[model samples]
Target: MSHTDPDRYVTRLFRDDYPILQGLVASGRLRRAAVSLPGWDKATVFEPLVPVSAHGDHHLRLGYADLGAQIYALPSAPYAAVLRASGDYRQPAGIAGLQVCFGAPDLDAATFRAELRASLAQPLKLDSTPHLATADHGGCHATWWPNRTLILESGGDWFLALAFNLETRVIRSPGKSVFGIDLNADPALCIADSAGVARMIGPRHALLDGLRREHLDRPLAPKEVRVVRALGYASGRGPLEVALRDMLSRAEAVGVEKLDTRQLYARFVERSREQAALDWHVSWLPQALYRARIRLHRVDPAFSTQACHRHPSHLGIVRGRMFDCPLCTELQHRDKNAARNIQARTLAVHRHPR
Candidate 1:
């Protein structure tokens, strides 16, 4: 078991699959998938990676034993991208390669390493936990599991890591039924359930949800909103994380299962170059949900908006704004009703494929 090789090499990790995943997203092959959890609404697929939108320029708060630790952000593009891509996972699957080996080239190598150099830095105290300090900048700690994020030095002037998190890895589902979520740029997101109830957690409430609950802030100014949204497009905040967090927190108070919404969109649409970032959320949200121990689902997105659950009629064009069933007149929110119809269609096609 302790055998050593003169030459060692590692293959790609799941997050490495991100580029392909990103392509899948652009092609509309990937959609949010959901499997319900008992005490909460359905958890979308595991998206352990935090979208770059929320954490870009955010510091990494590190700790050792009980000594003080400091938060730092690496300036290298690949490092940031790898971290952004896998950040939400239970652990950061390590990254290793020749170009990014040892350290980021753009960074002052000595300065960057000095932070982790031990001799050059002072340790800070951790004073807050559960309830501590002010909400504005008060924070929690992140621990490292052996699950993902292991980097090493290669002998021939190279460094490499296989970045992936085992703790948050995707697994077969244990749920009985599926829930579908159809997305709209209007309200942001929607959810539909089996009992014919549709719900939504729109943008306004989502913004108020804040990065952390204890330290809520006033509404984001218009400019700030654009930046955050754009990050989701470029790096990502994995939009559903906040939405699910807000909904599940309320569901906890009511002692009801929190529902999750699966994102469904069309592949047949035109893409504007400026809107490329719009696709970032899809690749990362599931990993974020996985860290939260939630599940996400995806269904065939075609006509999810027009087709009514009560009838097979494409009753109205662009009919997803409000849920109005022409046959029985069963009214629902456009997104909510669409979610129900999506769930029905996805289940009919593949009944909980492993």
Candidate 2:
């Protein structure tokens, strides 16, 4: 058996507990729990039919055989309808969930639906059975195939999070390409691969700025403003995902600048304070990197833009969009240069592991 860092591999199973389970937790009978799934590589959390509160609900956990099946299941019928009904659904102005429809564009609906129904049958059986795994303290059981083990703890109420513990060793990438990314306040992502190819995902600040302007004069609720920015991020994600997928098709790892929010906000003020609000919309970039299964390295951002990638001692003049390096033959896009520098630094760190 491959050993896992218990802390890292521990996936949360439920969010809020049912009243009976909550009572058990309150009475000190149960506090925390752990489960062991020997061969499963993926899992899913479904919102229960009823919720404890608007915010807190008991969610169910089920193991998936693979990612394709999981994606096929997520956008099916009721779930798809709910996603479409969301204010942010399919909106370019929302968060990263704008992809209302999951799976391939031309996925065979009839075949996928049939397969989804068959796959769900076993787990859905638990709805009526409601089996408990019988830990040292009481714990809910998950209906998964192959093998299962459940353990318990005596801590206070857990966070309302459903985590899926994936064994890191299970998902192995054959590619050896490394990529470095630079995220700009323009709400754009510039990627530089080891092969020297560089591409920009989006200069999405305009849409966010437009959103701010549209809502700036209104006396709307914070949710309304947030929804607009979320749509922007969601829309931005389409290009970002496309870029990442293309990069990862030949890459096993990715490197990104370790951003300092204080410096970012300060830079915003230097540019124009009016556009600073764009920061919130683009903040999803870091979260998006983590969502991928590939190896990730965060390189230091100090001097990433100012120093010349060709000659470390020579500083580069960073104008609005271009970098003029004294040692370089021609002008380079500031973000792309920064991305290349980030890639080089990441490679250095990996080669000489300190």
Candidate 3:
């Protein structure tokens, strides 16, 4: 059942599973439909019928086996059918053609061949396991069943996107303390703990630094731009992820300002040129917090920057990055105050969810 070579493994998989698939189709449990190939008009593939929500099982399922690796065998039929329709389903030439169509021009043929071969040997698994219980990353955590597997052809390249059915669960109650986080455009994240301690993580602007170093002299191509952006996002996000996880380990819940993009976009346009990196933080921070297994509250961000944490009703005077509360006669960083307000809002919502 396990073969080292991807081509041989896939070829044997098709040969071994064809009869079982045909039997399922004959029994009306699976249906056959035409899977269009590039030049073929009549290629057929089999797929299981969509079932009701209450159904206990599916024709295709995902399971972990042999050394904790995930496995399944559903997409092979359609994949094989595409190759068969092209007259080279199980042939070495077919795989070569796939490389030509999908592989990068500068990609080493042998390396791409190895990658494809290894990829085919491993198939996507479908299951309804709760994502929160196993939130170490990898796998889609949407609240739906029998997740989809996608084989996309974009920009003359083939891509695989497998969606695993991850069950969404209610966030556990915050136990020890709550941390309020304020993510600002200034490449800094301010955290305020319920115990009245406040701190800031970065003004590093990791994404800006990465991009500047990458595109120092020449303008990059579209593909190069994408690669740069992705790399930048990854580098910038690493520290933030570590910080969030560390905070969650100590706190029962973390509250964040529910930033409205329109407001953020306006602020970015007026005050900064680091707008591109903002997109990554705005979209990813909430999801990351949720997946960290702590109660994540998106508190209203309204007036957080303006209102003084020490005296809520007294609005603060903003002087550059510092805030001066008229009543307290002391100056504090704006982000620290915002973090405190976010923490207070989270506590309010947590106490009265109604």
Rank the models by TM-score, top first. Answer: 2, 3, 1
lDDT of each: 0.33, 0.42, 0.46
Best candidate, TM-score: 2
Please give, for residues 1-354, the per-residue lDDT of candidate 3 as tens digits: 222211100101212344444455577755554443331233343334533121111122212100110111112222222222222112222323332323233444345334444534444223233211113322213321222332223222222222322222333344578888887756557788889888776455433443355445644544333323322333343445455545645667778776665567567522222332343245334444444455778788888999998899989888889999998867998989988998998888887887
Query: 1-354 in candidate 2: lDDT tens per residue?
Result: 222322111122232333444554455443333333322223221222222111101222222100111111110111222232223222222111222321234434344333433433333221211111011101111112111223222233222221222221122347567788887755466788888887876654443354355444643354333333223333444455455446535556677777654466456532321222323123222222343345667788899999888787789899999999988999998888888998888788766768
lDDT of 1 by residue, 11-88 (tens): 112232334444433554433334322212322332223221112222221111111101111111222333344333
TM for candidate 2 is 0.49
Q: Could you say which candidate leads in lDDT?
A: 3
- Candidate 1, position 203, lDDT: 37
Which of the predicted structures, 2 or 3, would earn the higher TM-score when compared with the native? 2
Q: In model 3, what is the error at residue 341, expressed in angstroms?
A: 1.0
Misplaced by over 4 Å in model 2 are: 1-162, 165-175, 205-207, 221-223, 261-293
